[model samples]
Every structure is written in structure tokens, then in C-alpha cells.
Target: MMISRKLVYVASLSLGLSLLASTAMAKVEMNAMCFMKQSESTAHAFNPTKEEIADSSILKKNPTNVTDADVDAKFRIASLSKVITTDWAIAKLGPEYRFKTKIYVTPGTKAGNCNLHIEGDMDPYMGREMLTRIFTQLKPKLTAQSCKYIETFSYDQYFPVYLDAMKHQTNHDLGWEDPARYFNSTKTKNDLAAFLKVKSGLKGDFSNIGVVTKDRYQEYLKGVPSKVYSVKSRPLFMIAKDMNKYSYNYPPNVLFEKLGGAEAYKKFAADRLKLDGEDVEMYNGSGYPAMIDGKKMYNLVSCSALVHIMQDLDKTLEAYKGTRKFQMADVMAVGGPGESYSTFKGLYAGGTYDNTMVAKTGSADKAITFGGMLSTADGDMYFAVLTSPETYGGADTTKARVIIRELVQTLAERQKLKKFEYKQIGDMNATDDQSTLVEEPKQTPAGSLK
Candidate 1:
């Protein structure tokens, strides 16, 4: 068939624009091009088509933009990686892998001067209620009464110090120390208790449910753990929800640590997705501390990747029917016209007096960070945005927010489209075999839904 003139014209125009964009972008140190598309899960697995693709590496008019042969440019993903990682975990491990911070008394249970071994399987926002549950459970029974905490404390005891769930720091020597470290309690055990107290607005002389200052003394049990020990932490889905809503860093990192260690997941991602060691760089899991360029820097992803992952998570809505009410997407963070103001983004970002977006975000080494999903006010779409590596330019997260908002705007616009910039977006070679099994609520294919 003879080439159509209309087709030729559009291709030429896009090529010219992409080339121009490349030239302009290269002037900025390093570069990379990656377009994200909404993903649909097929019976066999998942595939993201190109019509869903949106790009930032180049304008739409480059003369020599990459042909289908060049989809391998190292696109930096930043916190956009959170959704990718989280969804992968859910898909692989099943959604039932929700976090549970459990409190246990050391075997042969002892009181004062005796240890209360607590194991928090990585829940960041798991503040006071969970703590109160532990205290309340052990309340009438905890044997420690008027005992003294040893002065020599291991500083590393207090930790929300997770970098990536699936990975760990090569070195465990954290520099500065926290007073909470003295609690060796690091707050999860007691800080959690205090936070619960504040949350319940519990009445008088109930003063010291969970409090630890310079000194932590043991006392007889009086608190109730079960009245407070109620809900399964908002669910991993909700945790991801809140992460995006707040654009908070700590939780995303914690989730990564909780879901799987960073190192292990990287291996999982590589095996599952078949990642080339050089195609992407995996550091500290989140965006900061590293970057990517056109040559192929996968240090992390961007706001674009974040939204695409949300699209995948949205597909699983049929599973959470019994637990959650649908949440609003991160409208502001997603970046369409008044996306934040008119949609769920604001709710999650603390937009309205009520309602909220829930998602995970990450920021490290002064690098700007982003992650979070938005459910619009209309309640149909979910938008998630994540950004990183711009600490090289923009100021704090405010600038990152603008970039994230734009990324969301672009991706959501793609969601509204019918045609493509003209190409397929994923690589068949892109499967993640390194996946570890994740348990869930008996999953069916995405197609099983209406």
C-alpha cells in the first residue's frame, strides 16, 4: 500500500518536534525519554498499550525522535516507582499481605527489667491506635512495674529508618541518634501508644498511655489494647492511598521496606520484568540519591509512571468491595485543570475540610519527590503522581508538586484520548520474573470485572 500523505505529515511533524525537544533537553546535563500509558491486566498478565503513552522527553515535533526501536532510553521514574513496585507486590504476593504491627511479650514472659519484644512489620502511619492496642492488650497484664530502663541504649533501636522495602543499606551505621532511640523503643511501641491517646481524645489521668522522654520507666498495666486494636491498617491499598494524599515521604519508604526488602524486590523486578542491569539503576528504592538520563538512567521513575500504576490498581477495585469506600484521585497532584481543587487530590492532600486522597510518596538526599493517587470528585478516575531527581533544579516539594501536577495533567489527558502519538508503549521483553509470591483476597484476572 502506498503511504498515506496524512500519516506521513503527522509522523514528520512529530519527528521534527521530538528532535527539537531532544536537543533542548540534552542541554540540561542528563536526559531520558519514557512515556506512560494506562495499563489493563490481561488474562495471562498485564500489558500497557502505546495509545495510552504520554511523553515529556520531547515536544511533539522532533525530526528524529526515537522510532519504535528506541523505547529503551533510560527514563528516570522517581517515586512513580512506588505504584509500580506496590502493584507488582500486590499482583505477585496477593493483596492479603496487608501490614500488621504486632506486639509480643518475650517468651517466658517477664515484667520490669524484662524485655517486651515488639515486631512492627513496617507500618509508618501506624501511629497510636495500633500502639494503644498493644498497650491495652498487655495493659491489665504487663508485669513491668516501676522498673528502670538501662542507660546504655543501642541508638539504632528506633527505626522508621527504612529506605526501600525490598532492599537494605549496605551499611547499617546511621549517623545521628534520636532520644526515642533510648526507648530502644524507637516510638513504634510507645510513640504509637501516645499517638493513639491523642487520637482518641481519651479522658483524664489517662495521661501516660504512650510517652517516653529522656527516661522510660516500666509501670503496671492499665491500658486496653483491643478497644483500640480494631482495624487492619487502612489496608495496603489505603496506605498507598494516604501516601499519595499526603505526598508524604516516610510511609512510601516504609511500605517498600514492609512489602519486600529493596534488594529482594530489585531482584524480583529484574527476574519478573527481565530488567537489564544497565537499563535502570535501583538505589535506595525511592527517587532521591540517584537519577536517569536518555542513555538509560532508571534511578527512579516520574509522575507519569505513578499514574500508570494507579490505573492498574484501579482495575482491582472489585476486590476491595467489602472494606473501603472509593477514594478520590490526587487531582492537584495529578495536575489537570483544577485537578487538585475539583477532584479527590485535594481531599487526599487535605484539600477539603474532609475527604482525602491516599498514596505513597518518597524524597531522599534533598531530591524532590512525589507519589500519590487521586480519585476525582466525579468519582470515576484515579490519578497518581510521583517525581524525583529535580533537587538539581527546583526548590523543595513545592516545585516537585508543580512538575507532578503537570505529569498528572499529561497522563490524565492521555486517559481521555482515543488515538496515539503513534506507537505501542511496552516491551514484550519487559516481564518481571523475579517476583516473590504475594498473597491476596483470591484474585481473578482484571477481565473478570465488568
Candidate 2:
């Protein structure tokens, strides 16, 4: 009996040590893979830095030959900046926060000349159909009062002016000839007038509508502006879904404005994320236009800093998943075969990463970036890959995407060996069974934006 017990103990100890050795080997492999080769053309300029953290321990880091300054160096994260903007908005405003547009009516001196004020709360997704609904709700009241003509029609001047400046700045940076592409304040007002006219059966075009100056905006505040009706935008999470999925610029730009412009946004992120002043910097919500004033001034964030932010975002989202109908995957683009906004779907779809990676991708002339959480058998792993401008140029994102995939796949494989229970946040639609995998969720219809 003593000899049998000794044999069993020896076997168990050998198995434990083997597992540890395997884990250590996997870590070494991952560390080696993280060091990407620099391009010959710009080998001098190429500076690649990556950091991966799992369970509060650094799994892989390539800091050799790269100084602390290089590790801390900020690269233009491109659309990855959207992750920061959307994450910040979600934290500050909650996932369910909605933008409100209010309609006010006041008696006019003449029989058919009452003033109508449409106050906008910077709702970026407000569309013609939504305006029609607002007008439809207020039609009965207006018709009952015999209000045939709108004597003075005005909207919030502050937001329109700010939007104009933002549009101009974006156009200037992109060298876009048509500033109207970004935003046309006049067109928006006119569209609102047309929609309201059709819905309310009112007469005349916006020529009859008056523009409210900053000074005139206060007059409506003197007397209680009789509220006729109002419309609330879709929840912030839904907006975030479209923003990250499509890499839409307007929504995030407007959101940053709502958060009190770029400078204020930086301060807010620094305070909330506990990041140093140099750790995060963003001129615009989107990281396009890699330069400003001859110097490349794109949104700069270190890999580790972004990974930490992503981890915090994951925790914040977990708190809401149980109570809310939407999940983090619903807001972020997922990898797979179907119509996903995941830029990596072309390369990673139908592969091992399908439905397992929920991330954001950013690319421009000088920088390529990707950062998000990867669900593994052990647990969730937060990762961010930032390639210096020298690594990619002109339409070639293949190298970056390929490297990211290999690294993630290696990590997943290592986790699988541990036999750790697979736990994932939200519904990632992941599966170990090869036969069960399907395409990603279809794109949300335009009407659903409401």
C-alpha cells in the first residue's frame, strides 16, 4: 500500500511540472512572435511596440532594444480613437443616455404667425423621418389653435455654430473641397422645415423662418416656452454600435463636442482612466489626417494604456449586460463571415478567431492600429497593436493584420492547454465545435437607428 501511494504521488508531481513547463514555453514563443520585423525601406524609422496582459500579469512584452521612451511613445491609433471616445461617452453618459430635441410654441401677435423654436441637443443621428414624427405629434395642437404659418422659426444657435466650425476644421484637415459633406447647417435647417411642413400641413419654405442669434435665444427663456413635443435619439450604445462598426466619424466628432470639445475630452479621459497627461492625446475623435500643422498630430496612445482602457471598458460593460438588453458585442464589431464591420473579417473570418475577437481597427497613411478583448478558454485577454508609420503605407494592411492574428491564435492555443473553463463576457457567439460556427450578426438596418 505504501509503494502504490508513492508511485501515484510521483506521477501527479511530474504532470504538474510538465504543465508548468508547457505554459512557460508558450510564453516564450509569444514573446518572440511579438517582435515584428521592420521594413527595409524605413527600418531606421520603424519602431514596433506591443504589450499583452492576462490575469494582471504581463504575458508578453518586446521592450529590448526599445527604450522606456519608445514603450511610452504614442502612435496615431486612427479609428482606435473611436474606442476611446465611445468608451468615455459610455462611462460618462451611461449606455442608455439619449439626446433630446424639443419643440416649443409661443403665441404670435398676428392670427397665423406664431413662433416655433426647435431646440437641438446635438443629436447627431436626428434625421428627416425623426423630424416628421416630432411634427406629427405636435400637429394636432397647432391645427387646433389655427396656426397656419410659422412667423418665426428658429433652432439652437450654439450647436449649429459649433458644428459649422467643426465641419470647417475637418474639411481643412482633409483638404476636402466640399465642406457641406461634413455638415451643412443651412441644409439641415431647410430639411427640418420641409419635414415639418409636410407633416404639420404648414405653408411656405424656410425663407419665412427666422434665424435665432445667440442674444435672441435668451428671449424664449424669459417666458415658459410652451412645450409642444420632443424626440429622443437612440440609446448611446446603439450609436456606439454604428460608430465603431462603420468607423463613422461624424457621430464621435459630435460626441466629443458634446463632452465640451477636444481639450475637455482629454481632461475627462485622463481623470477617468487615471492616465498621465502624456498617456492620451486626441485632436479629434477620429484619428484620420495623420498630421496637423506640418507635424504628425494624430491621436496618440500607447499599447499598454489602450489595453488598460479596454479592460476597464469591459468591466463597465459587464455591469450593464445583466440589466440591459444589448451586450458589448452588439456595440462592437465582431469577427466572422457575415456582414460585420470588423475590418479583419476579410482575413480572419471563418478561422479560429471568428466570433472570438471583438475589436476596433484603425488605419491611415502613417499608422495602423487594432485593440480589443479576446475571449480565451482561460479568460479574457486585452491586447493592443500599434505599428509605426514606417511599417505600412498606401493600402497595405496585410502585414499588420497577419501579425495580429498569429499572436492572438498562439495565445488562444496556449490557454486551451491549461484546460481552464471558458468564460466569456456577453454573447460572443463563440464555439469550440467546428460545425456550429456561423457568420457574424447582420448589419443593423438604417431604420433601427431610431
Candidate 3:
């Protein structure tokens, strides 16, 4: 008896599906084993529920604690908060937004002495090199005036106020121990002054350098004096990249203050991302809040909430990519086996998973978290994992890295079994591979400037 063509096609389809199901079952088992190893009753682990970005379908999840790993359970995200802060900044401030510092000269009665006023716009990355650049631009003007000594160097008073606010907001008491030293404004100012003195052959030392009073500051803003030059910060993405790559606390804290603090950022996230307010709690943008009663009061965000935020951020980034050279990978830290600014750089670099993982890592006394995107041959998957203090016994970054590596490997293997190609979000290759070796450039010393 001759079988119909339709019957033959149906038979082939049945066999294909059976093989697919068998492979999927094997993946589930592997994920379960991986989760069990981490779950060992010692740590509370919130593993990833991998999904296809194209269709938002769950590709794989830990089989053991599917119910325990409540997607909405709040976990302290530590430095992972940088991811949210950076994305919010990109959305609200725009990726190209540059902080500005306006320079003004109040001509002095003394031939060699002049008062130099620096009106800061909170350029977080303002540093010695940037100062050199700004001063170089101002050198010709200073020479034209025959300026020899900077008798008085003043900055916007708001700079210190903002820094103080960050200290208070993050409950960083250590920030005040030597506000002058910690802020490093005085040193920066001295450095700038020294740089100018040497460059211009000035004789006298920079005598009076401090914050401008409100009354005096107003006059300068009204164009009473000569405006000399202005220097702009690097693009916001560059700053955000450093914030995530090194888990730097100050940049995000400053950004948080610019947004009007914790409550403000929460409202912004809720309204813009459509996230539930209760699911997202942030006391500071840096995710390094003061501890209370032996527990950290860091930012709290659910794994599910974080994953959703990442998805929304990816969409925003994709939209921006159409008009400019911007992508989420351009801002967030890349992990897994490369000379990149990754928390896991030394541990995972040149390993089996090298160049496949891009993530932000967070660690506080009470928790450690990892959230970002993982790229596989099938596609990119956004994920978040939270390990509680009670579970891990403390913030064990080494353990966290190991688990995250295993988790990513499991998801990649699972994706292989499904044979589903996920749409890539951004260029995974666009990373600063050298960031692993060198530390992020320190901000201009705020105290030194004072």
C-alpha cells in the first residue's frame, strides 16, 4: 500500500517534535541539577527564568525551586542598581548629554593676580586630564591678559552641597571624615593651579580658592565679568559605563541626587517602565546604602522586575541606535573571559565562557546579585540572579561568579536544544577590553578644589 505524501510529511514532523522534546527534557534536568548545587539549603538563590526576547517565551528555568523563586520577591541588588540608574539617565538626560563647567575671570586690580571662577555643572568625570584640557584652552586667553598668579580660585558652591547630599543619602559617614580629602577638591584645584603656574610661569601661589557665595555667584552669572572658557564632560554613556564597570558609588549617587533622590527615581522607574512601585525600592542610585541592625538597606528589586527593566532598557537602546552610535552594551559592563571592566574579569577571563556574558554585579553585606544579558548562538537572554546573605552566609563574590557562569552555560545549552535564534540587541563586540587591567580614572578631587 502506497502512503500518501501528506502522511509521510506528518510522520516526519512527529519524529522531529519527539527529538526536540527529548532534548528539552534533558536541558530541564541539567538546569535542575545546577540549581540544586547552588540551593544546597545554605543559600537562597533566585535563578533566571530565561526567555526569548523576540516572543517573551520562557525558554528555561531552574526546575527545583520554580515556586520558591518567586519572580517578584525583592532582593538587594547592590551595584546592579547602576544598570537601572544608567538606563534611566540615558532615557531622561539622553545618551549625548554632557556635563558642563563654565570658566569666568574676574579681572583683578593687581596686575599679576586674578580671580578664576569655575561654575560646575557636576561633571562627575572631571579629572586632572580634563582640567589640563580646559586650562590649555584657557591658556591663550590668560596669556593675552598677562595673568601671572591666580590670587583667588572659586567654584560653584553647589558642588560641595551636592557631594554632602550624596554622603547623607547613602549614609556614608566616612565621606565626611575628611570631606576635604574624600572629595579631593582642594588637591584638584591645587593641581590645576600648579599646572597653570608651571605652564604660564606664574610666580605667586593660588591664594584664595573656595566656593563662591550665592550673592557673588549671582553677579558672575549676570555677565558682570569676562567669561573665559567652558569644558564639557564625556557623553553620559561613557560615565555610565564606568559606573557599572567598576561599581563606582559616587557617579550613580550623584545622578540619583540629580534625579531628586530615591523616591524620585522609584517614581520615574514606575511611570516610565510600568514597574510596580512595591516591587522596586531604591534608597540610593549606587545600591550601597547604610546598614541597619546588621542588615544592609541597599536598593531592593526583584529578579523579575530587574529583567523587565533590562528588557525595557534594551528597547530604548535599540531605538537610540537608529539615530546614533549607542547600545546597552556600550554602557553596561561585559563579563566572562576578556580584558574587560567586569566584576568577574580576573576569575572568568579567558575561560570557557569568555566573550559571551555581559552583566552588572552587585555585592552588599546582605546580598549579592547579577543581572544583564547573555549571548548564545541562539540569541541573547536577559537574566537576574540574587543570592541572599542567609543563603550564602555573606557576600561571596567568588561563589556568585561560579554560579553565574554555570547558570549562563546551562541557559546556552538549553537554547541550543531549542534551535531558536533570538534577535540580537546590540553589538556584543563593542567593549573596552583594556578596562580589566586599568582602574577607572578617578574623578577630579572635589576636596582639592575646595
Candidate 4:
């Protein structure tokens, strides 16, 4: 009996030791690094600096251990994909670009009827608020013009669906639908009716919403013997600011699709940054898990690559042709007291990071990533951190964030950190659609000072 008991104790002790060994070996894999602008250069040139606690295996192409990776190692960068998407938008579209929707109206041969043609520019943010404002303006004009009923309403499919979705608060997942076939003509007509009934204050039914293609619309435009009214969306930077502030998945994907989708962005990065294909792979702008060819794809980027991209984006923002100078926070969420609804609200709030960090954060089932600029007295320091745990969930995200907080603390301790000079735009949900009537610019005074 004593010998049997001794054998059982020995087995239990061995099993415990084995478990401990495995637990010790299973560390979180990560790659975190930063780059600071050279102090003396007029052109902001970055000097790469290592400030991470990672495993040595991180340098290898396929990292076995999770702990030690260098800046060059690749990892899934979740919401950080928004940062890259914003970079592409600013480069391709410029800062002042606005999505415009053209409205053409021709008085019908009969009384109290008019044909309305709306050409949508695929403006992603054309939601309920914008439509309401648009209709409010249109209603007064149409009433003054003596048109009671819209005899023939012609428009692209997306505009009506956007109107319906925004009015009903049903556009929760904007990226999942095929834009070309999202809504039928019948549904679009009904949606337009519902919208006009509630918001437009127009009398009589608006029948027949023709879902016309762009080519067909161009032909129609040539036949129209009347003026065109245009409504312009808010500038791209403001739209991007709200997108990153809340880390909404829809806007980035919409803007990305407009810029030519994920593959195009991958090629853009490769061409512009001279990055190796192995270093960066973007499946979507939102960094959401998507299946292509029956395989799940995620955005993967090296810390070094992300930091370099940030440097590029910053330079672009500084040179933006806007009335006010733009900074990283103009398009990226900033950490602070006022940014209560931003992505960094809970994670980076308080004196340590308040108004000092402008970044994008990403979290998935097994990945947690963050990258952005940290304002310091030395100069702006850009960083990217990617983490993959053995098992990750909501709790794991918290743990990863705690680690990130500590890392930021360590970095802050080393530098004379200062607050970034930018103000938050507050909550995204409360924001109104700031679209405006596109009017011809007034001529400047002959002797106006330049």
C-alpha cells in the first residue's frame, strides 16, 4: 500500500513539472519597434530604434516562439489597416477631395410634375442625416418651382439604399453587400417614397426610381436641357478622422473599395514603399477576417513597414493643401480626456498618454496590434506593435493592452513626452452629415492680397 502511494505521488509531481515547463515556454509572440525623426534634418528622416521585448525567433521568416521578434517580422495588424487606408486616400485623392452627387431636374410637359435624375458619386457616408438635409433643400426649391409630384425619379441603386438604410438605422454592416446588386429597383422606389414622406415634406408620390448605369446616365445627361445641382460631401480628411476615431469597419472598407480594393492597395504599398510581398499582405482595409478563394485572409505587416508608412503619411499630412495644417491626429485617433468615444479612450486615457499618442488599434481572435505616433520633445516617434498569443479573446485583448500600456510607460519614461496639439471631434455617432450645396466659387476681388 505505501509503495503504491509513493508511485502515485511521483507521477503527479512529474506531470506538474511538465506542465510548468510548457507554460514557461509558451510566451506571447510580438514585434514592437519605433522610429524617431532625425533632430537636425529639415526633411523629417526617421532613424529606426528598437524598444521592444520580443523573442530572438521574431527575426526568422516563420517564428516558432511567440516572444522575440524584430521590427522586420510580420504579424497580423488588425485595425491598423485603417491607418494604411487613410494614407492611400490622402495620396490618391488629396485632402480637399469631396464626393459629389449631381441632381438634374427637367420640368415635365404636364403641370405639377417633374423628372428627377440623381447621379451618385459612390459617397460612402451618404446616410440618413445627409439625405434629410438634401431633401430639405430640395423640397423648398421644388415647391417654389411648382412641381408637386416627381413623375420619373432616376438614380443609381446605391443612393436609395443608403437613404433607406440610414433612415431606418439598418446599415450596421456596410461592407458585406455587393454594391452593384445591393438593392432592386422596386425596393429602391419604396425606400425613396418612405424617405420623402418622412423628411422631404413633398406632396404626392415619387413613382418609378430607374436604376440606371453610369453610361446610361451620361446619355440621359446629354438630352437634359436644364441646370444641374450638386451636393458635396465633407472633405476626405474629416471623414477619415471620424473613421479612425471610432474604428468603424464600414467606412474604411468603403473608402478602400473606392480606391480599388485590397489587391490594389497591396500593390500600391509594394510600389511606393519598395516593400517585399512577404513583408506586407492586405486582404481588406478594415482588417476584418475575410475569405477569398475559400481561405481566410488578414492584413499582415511588419512593424518596420508600418512605422515607415506612418512616416510617409505624416509627411503627406504636413504638406496637405488645407487652410489649417494637418497632423497625424487629423486622421488617426488621439489619446486624451476629451476623446471619450475614441478607440484609445479606456486604454490610453489619463496624464501619461493624454493628448500625446495618436494611433490605431486592432484586435482579433488571436491577434492584437497597435501602431501610431507618440509626441515627444525630441521629435515625433512612430511605432508599431503586433502580438499573437497562444489563445486570444476579449480577456486576452485586455492582457495585451496592459502589456502595451506598460511598454508605453517605459517609452514615455525615457523621453520628454508632450501633448500633441490637436483637439478631438468627439463621438462619431453624434456627428451630423456635413454635406453642403456645391455652388460656383465667387470671383476674388481684383486687389485682394495674396
Candidate that scores best on TM-score: 4
- The best candidate in terms of lDDT: 4
lDDT of each: 0.35, 0.53, 0.54, 0.63
Q: Give the TM-score of candidate 1.
A: 0.47
Candidates 1 and 4 compared by TM-score, better number: 4
What candidate 2 gets wrong by more than 4 Å, as runs, is 1-69, 158-180, 183-201, 208-218, 290-296, 321-327, 337-341, 347-354, 389-395, 417-450
For candidate 2, lDDT tens digit of each residue in 1-450? Answer: 011223322533233234334333221111111111111111111223343333211223222243345545666777888888777887778887777665666666677656777767777655543554556556666777677766767777533322232232223233222223454467666666565566556653456654576456656455433434555666677677666765666667668777776788777777777777677877777665533567756677766567667766666776764455544565677654344333444333312344566778776655666666666554556666665434353223444443444344434444431121222232212111221212223232222100
For lDDT, candidate 2 versus 4, the one ahead is: 4
Query: lDDT-based ranking, best first?
Result: 4, 3, 2, 1
Find the 10 residues in a row with the least total lDDT in model 3: 30-39
Whole-model lDDT for model 1 versus the true structure? Answer: 0.35
Among residues 3 or more apart in sequence or in different chains, the pairs in candidate 4 whose N, CA or C atoms overlap within 3 Å are 29-66, 54-68, 55-67, 55-68, 58-69
Error of 2 at 361 (Å): 0.8
Task: Identify the runs in model 3 with alpha carbons over 4 angstroms from their true place.
Answer: 1-69, 158-207, 213-216, 220-223, 291-296, 321-323, 335-338, 347-356, 376-380, 390-397, 416-450
- Across 253-362, the per-residue lDDT of candidate 3 in tens digits comes to 66766667677777787788777666798876777764457764767777666776776666676677434666566677654334333454433331233345556776
TM-score of 2: 0.67
Residue-level error in angstroms, candidate 4, position 379: 1.3
The regions of model 4 sitting more than 4 angstroms off are: 1-28, 31-70, 157-193, 203-210, 293-295, 390-392, 428-434, 438-450
